[model samples]
Target: MKRLVLLLTFLCPMGFIALNAQSSSIFIGATGGANLSKFKFTEDLKELYPASNSLLGLNGGVTIGFEVQNFTLHTGLQYIQKGSEYQTDNFEDEQGTGFYSATEKLHYLSIPLLIGYRKYL
Candidate 1:
């Protein structure tokens, strides 16, 4: 299942380029970046978790674009991960308790399609 999706993601662009090869210019590139994810809480919640910090994440993807004259079409597939970590002060209750901590991690699959027109300077 995964392989099929990956194959299609790459092949679909090739198909477009092949069909437009005679009249359009083809562009293929790789993209990557860093992400800092953080969580903000309200006044009441902030008091419970005094120690909050941003988590580091990474993203990377492939890009393909076709240009015909001043008009262009582009698309890409990307994988992104973003999340945050939270920690709370220790609290006492009827039962013995320890400090509380939580980590959230989210994953995303991104597909962007774009059309563009260029202006000559």
Candidate 2:
């Protein structure tokens, strides 16, 4: 749910750019990057628990584009890994009191499309 929203937040601008692009010469390229992410719990959860730590992740993909003069239209597919490390100290429940550590990971397939116009000074 939240993840989906976050994904869309990241992709929507690119989609809007792609839809508005005015270019036609094709070009191909590769893209890769590392991402650091953390879990952002809801207010309800935060009231009762500590925030989680960020985890390092990686993303890689291929990009295709169309260029016309100074303008370009681009699109790509990427593999993304998002994760976080969580720890709780003196966590108490009906069972008992203890410390806990957990790691979470999620994988996503993303497609980003955008248009760019470059100018030289």
Please name the candidate that would achieve the greatest TM-score relative to the true structure: 2
TM-score of 2: 0.71
- Tell me the whole-model lDDT of each prediction, alpha carbons only: 0.85, 0.83
Tens-digit lDDT string for candidate 2 (1-121): 9999999899978755765575456789999999999999898776445858999999999999977677777898989999999877757756676676789999999999797998968
Candidate 1's C-alpha runs over 4 A off are 1-22, 42-47, 90-97, 119-121
TM-score for model 1? 0.64
Clashes of each: 0, 0
Give stretches of model 2 more than 4 Å off.
1-24, 90-97
Over the stretch 1-121, how does candidate 1's per-residue lDDT look in tens digits? 9999999899878767766665778899999999999888889888888888899989999999988778777899998989889987665545667677789888899999988999889
- Backbone clash total for model 1 is 0
Among these predictions, the greatest lDDT belongs to: 1
- Clash-forming residue pairs, model 1: none
Model 2: ten consecutive residues of lowest lDDT: 15-24
